[model samples]
Target: MPIPKVQKLFQKTFFGIFSMFGVIGFSTSVLCVYTVDTHLSAEYESNSRDIAKTIADSSVDILLNRDLATLQSLIDQFVEIQGISYIYITDETGTFLAHTFVPGLPEVIRQSDPSNTDTVERNLPGMGDFVEVGSPILAGVGGAVHVGMDTGLVALKIQRAIGQQIYLFSTVFIIGVFAAVWFVNLAAKPLGELLGYAVALAKDGAKAPPSDSLLRRNDEAGQLARLLLHCAGFTDADNKRGVAAPGEAR
Candidate 1:
């Protein structure tokens, strides 16, 4: 059976370059997104936990005195902080002492274990997503202070960061494509000539000697072309009769 046709060196080289750049760009984008998400999520959660503990610490004395009004004012001031969507305090009995929710407290907030000190993600109906952080008031003696950090805002920041990175990588990939095309074309020219010469020699006796330009090339392709010429039995006198390409010595 006749051998199946194979892609030329030009096509293979260009495709290989393209694939390399594509893989690198895609991997970088994924890594950047993951890094941005991890760092931002951690920082936001830390901020929420810190704020919750701070409010809880300050509210300890106020809560002991049964100063609900002052506790409400204190949390009201902190609720204005960025990324903090809501704030609430609960008694040891789990009854809501004060909350920033407009209509009512969320069931998820009530379900949280005040004694457990951990950050958790929860979605409150009509309230979107939140990262809930609770700090026990007076180590669970006084009511616990819980803060809700907006997950939507955190996600938005991550998306914005990832978008910028993708844009940068896309720009680099585009520039790389052009460079790859130029490099492949530059590298393929001499290979194409050598292939044609080899194929001609195989099909019939190579009557036409290699050009002086091929003989005078300073690169590896020039060496291969000269080797092919020598193997083809073309003497120095034969190529000496041909003219070199401009700016090259035979």
Candidate 2:
């Protein structure tokens, strides 16, 4: 029975390594980006919630006395905190008492249910989107404090983090591809050189020794080459025995 020719082994190995690394790299990069996105958004929302709650606690007596100046000054200090877009305080009846919105409150915010004391999302006019968090003043008896946390800034931060991740993963992937190619070629080139030798020995009964490089290889291919040389007496000494090398190309 004839030995079947192995076709495209090099291509198969290259692509197999490429595909494995591609899938792993893609998935890992996606996971890292997702983790960063979630962590930052959650942290921003948590900070907003805490600030809202603190403002509510501080504004209890002030709101009850309708102390607008002190309440505005109290909220002014927090606006400088990164990701803080705006802060507004309201009464228990959901009436807006003090706010940082100079032009006026957006209707999107106005339409939101201030009674629902929880973190929510809002888009203010000309200010972009925000993660809005509400905390009840005096535990819902005095009023509520609503804080808008800037989401655009959070998105920018996430983008920067994810960009670094992509750069790192891409570098690793490129290096892996080069390694795969080199390794596959290292194995395949020896076999390619042996193709003609195999055909001559198997079909023509010719015994001219294989190429020096093939015989000198340190891998399994080299071992097989030396073994064939021994079995068939296909050595330098045999070549001098007046037996001609096969007409086939090597």
Candidate 3:
């Protein structure tokens, strides 16, 4: 048998709801993460620039005097700050005066600009991800201070946010599915009742018709129910008319 109009409507509505939620949830999650990541990136750059400037201001006097102990201690203090991977200071000739690590200076330090600070992400062999910030000390005349900060924590927070979004979206999707099923059943109820009534009439013409509750509704389903009830009565009237016609002709 062909599918009923009510069933078709249910199918279409369910599909539309599911598809719409899927797209909206996915797009919202992606946009939220992207927005957060962008903001975090900007925060990282701003924070690094500020920290580097602070270090530069503090180290300029000691750097000019070539006080290795004070510079080392100063850089060491800043290194203890959370998320700081390493900090170093270099002289006007690009020679490192003090550093938290003994590694050779990166080639970029030679080209460092004092007027403008710079930050870049580096993926080292053992390090997952590190961002290096450079600031010129003494207005580029004294030297420069470079700081590297760990980014794993920021990434972890982003992941946590994404997880929360997933959980929230999943809960909403489940509720929506259940609601769709309920609404479909509610919408199809009148049609179901009409079908049952037609079946009853087919089996036994003497059976009483459906109640007027459905016919009283203002909805399309009520209209259809009213039409079906009218057809049933019309059919009975036609039968009686045929019988009376034969009797009248005789």
Instruction: Give the alpha-carbon lDDT of every model.
Output: 0.78, 0.77, 0.71
Reference-based TM-score, model 1? 0.77
- The model with the greatest TM-score is 2
List the candidates' TM-scores in order.
0.77, 0.80, 0.75
lDDT of candidate 2 over 1-250, digit per residue (tens): 2323445876777777778878987787788778877999999889988999889888887876878999999999988899898998878788888888868988887877777777677777787998888888777888789899888998898788878877887898888888877776767776765666677777876456677777766666766666666666655665465323333122
Cα lDDT tens digits for candidate 3, 1-250:
1223457757878888989998998899899889878888678767777888998998777776878998888878878877777777777776667877546545454355423446777665554577888888767888788888778867776898899999999998998888878888887877777666666666665255455565556666566655555555645564343212111221
In candidate 3, which residue pairs get closer than 3 Å at backbone N, Cα or C atoms, i.e. clash? Answer: none
Q: What does candidate 1's lDDT look like per residue over 35-65, in tens digits? A: 8889988898888889999998898888888
The residue ranges of model 2 lying beyond 4 angstroms of the native Cα positions read: 1-7, 200-207, 230-232, 235-250
Candidate 1 segments exceeding 4 Å error: 1-7, 64-66, 110-117, 196-208, 227-250
Please give the lDDT score at residue 70 for candidate 1: 94
At residue 241, candidate 3 shows an lDDT of 39
Q: Which ten residues in a row are the worst by lDDT in model 2?
A: 241-250
**Candidate 3 residue-wise lDDT at 91:** 76
Candidate 2 all-Cα RMSD: 5.7
Clashes of each: 0, 0, 0
